[model samples]
Target chain A: MLAFQAGNLGAFQALFAKYQKKIIQFCHRFCGDQAMAEELAQEVFLNIYRGAAGYRPKARFSTWLFQIAVNVCLNEMRKEKYRHRIDSMDASPETESGKPRIKELCDPAPDQNELLEQQEREMMIQKALMGLPEKQRLALSLRVLNGFSYQEIGTQIRCSESAVKTLIHRGRQHLKELLENLYAGGDKS
Target chain B: MTCPYETWISAFMDGELTPQRADAMADHLAGCHGCKAKYEALTGLDQLLQSLPELKPSEQFERTFWKKVADWEENRSRRRLADWFKRGWRTVLAGSLALFILVFVSVFQGRFTRSLSPEEIILAEQMDVLQQYELINNLEILENWEAIAGEDESS
Candidate 1:
């Protein structure tokens, strides 16, 4: 980063290469759309470039980068006026058969029926994730998906460590409840 | 034995607890069926999360991103040049004012040193006129001296 700040284009490119996947993944989880995620990821890098001169090593680079990502995603959400909705996860019927045929050709250990079911479950989880309040979703994603430490999550989300833990806990509890409601017909015993 | 176990269980699941605390929580989970059930459920959730597929970027993502970065850098440079131009204009304006003041002072000083007094100027002009009148009178005396001398002797 210092090298980039010193006008090293190669250093900048190296940094971009290092973080592009993780940043895109983070934005994808936030927006639930690959295209929008890419857009947001680009915005995040642009912000880093613009703010590079002022980048003090006050925190780890990942923390600062995630902080910028969170802000960018939140701002994009606000601008687009996105409303959260909860629903049972289902695969798009058009793509499902084609994707599974490709997967089956690659590896045969996983049964196609089981894979489809697992994919639906993941889709449900994604839908549930979307239903979570933005802050909770961000906290949960940072902790669970990104494997950020509590303190690191706090730094990125601008909250205390304990608060980050609480957000994760509350987010998980809410998700568990929502899932139970969706699968209400199943016997708990 | 009565400590709140759920909090420690969560910390344990998150790998946040110290090794000793984690061992204690594991021991408690071994003996307590309720805590064990909760732990199992949480563990299942974690496994489910880990099983979620990683998303891959679409083809041409890199090319598109580099283009955007290039455009952004160009725009930033343009903005910086405009700001510099604005500051340059201000500097030029200030310098021109300073130079104007310096030139005005130099001209004023030169005029102060070489200028004439009003009385001296009027006296010099009167002396020139007096010399001219004496010369004219001498010329008239030369032209009619005998007649003028006879008139003066009679008077």
Candidate 2:
């Protein structure tokens, strides 16, 4: 980033090459939409490029990068279009044809049953993750998904390290309970 | 029953505790089944999250991003050009108006203070003499004013 700030544009390409996948995955987990994740990731990089002139190396580059990513995701979710989408998702797991989306998403494949099971489990985990309150979800994702420390998560989320710890703990507990309920419901049906 | 040490267990699982506190929590967890269960649950949850599949961008993601960047740069340049044009015209208009006002005021002032023509200069220099001549010509009329009024009444 500093090199890019010094007019070495190739340095920026190198940075992009290194962090692109991580950033995409982060957005994917945040919004639960792959296409939107790519879009948000592009926006994140655009902001970074535009803000390069003001880039200060006070914090780690990845920390600064993820900070922008988090803001972009939050802003997108705050938009009326995405807010409606999230509202529909919250209204029910199935918003189409009155069918369970989990089953609909998991089509049976004789050869890929294991892959199907893995995809199903991932979907359930993502749904539970989305069920968390925004702050908790952000804190947890920064910590668990991005492997940021409590201090880094606090910096990203604008809270105390202790508060971040508490958020992550509560987020984990909530996720556990949500998963349990989902599994129990699945078992019953 | 819930354990008070569950939060510590969560932090412990994350290796967030200080060494001394971590050791103490580890010892406590050995005897405390509930807190240990909480730790296990949190661990399982973390692992499950870590195991979530990685999502990759489409192959043309970089190409698309660079294209967007080019578009953004072009738009910004065009905006800067437009702003420069707008400001330039505004300044030019203001300057022209000021020059016009200055020219108009100077010309109006010059009309009053301009070098006098020969005829007007003579008129200005002899203006007191001209006034004296006019008074002399009207002296008779001024002196017979009462008699003239009486004659007109009789007629």
Candidate 3:
């Protein structure tokens, strides 16, 4: 980072090459949409690279980067348009029936019914994730999906290790109960 | 049934539990069938969640990201330049003010040296404004003072 701050473009290139995919993956988990994740990832890197000159290493660079990533995702979520759209979508009957909002946007063909089942299950998972409180979902995703350590997750989430643990606990418990209920309902149907 | 060690189960899963705490929780799980079931269920949840597929970005993602970094670096340079200019301008203002005071004092001592601390400077300004107002307001009385003095002498 210091090298990049000192006008070394090669250093910046190397850092971007190293972190781009991981950042994109993290963003994907945050927003659950590939295209939007990619856009947010771009913004994350842009902010990091822009602030490199002023970057003092208080925490590990990865922790700082993920912190920025979370902030970007939160910012994107806070936009009035995005929040309003989500509100109306959640209010719609189709979503109220527990169908993932993404499912309503894409329909399955008769021949691809099996594919639809898989997509629906995945979309359901995404919806369950979105249903979680923001901090819980983030902590859970960072630990489970992203494989970050409790310490690292704490640094990223700006909480203590114990708090991160609690978030993960509640998030996992909530998700498990949610999926169990859904599966039970499906079995009866 | 609510298990007291439910959160401990999660902590143990994260490998965050201390040795003594882990053992106590483990003992509870071993003795309590309910907690044991909950533990198994939570472990299953963790396994299933960890099994989520990792999606790889498109090949062009790297290219586009680097492009963004480059564009950001350019903008940063412009902003840095502007910031430097702002700092420079502020320093220039302070330096010129100091130099003006030094030259004025050397050329005319006590003739009206504006050598006042910030607080006194404000008070001096208020007094100056009041004196100017008093002069303007008493102008009509001063103009008629000569005729008034002659009438007093005749009386």
The most accurate candidate by DockQ is 2
Residue A61 displacement in candidate 2 (angstroms): 0.3
Query: What are the RMSD figures for all models against the true structure?
Result: 7.9, 8.9, 15.4
DockQ of each: 0.23, 0.30, 0.27
Clashing pairs in 2: none
Q: Which stretches of candidate 2 lie over 4 Å from their true place?
A: A87-110, B88-155
Candidate 1 lDDT, tens digit per residue, A1-189?
Answer: 889989998998998999998898888777765667778898899899889999998888888899999999988888734433111113342222244322421234477677777655665676667778899889988888888899999888898988887788777767776666655633453
Find the candidate with the highest TM-score and give its number.
2
Interface RMSD of 1: 3.4
TM-score of chain A of each: 0.80, 0.86, 0.78
Cα lDDT tens digits for candidate 3, A77-113? 8888556545564344243335443443334434456
> How do all the candidates rank in terms of lDDT, highest first?
2, 3, 1
Candidate 3, residues B1-155, lDDT tens digits: the string is 57777768888887889999998998898899988988899889878766555556655667887787678768879999999897989889999999999998778876666578898778687987767987888898889999989999999
lDDT of 2 by residue, B12-43 (tens): 87789999999999899999988888888889
| i-RMS, each model, one decimal | 3.4, 3.4, 4.6
Superposition error at A42 for model 2 (Å): 0.8
lDDT of 3 at B3: 70
> Model 2 residue B58 lDDT?
68
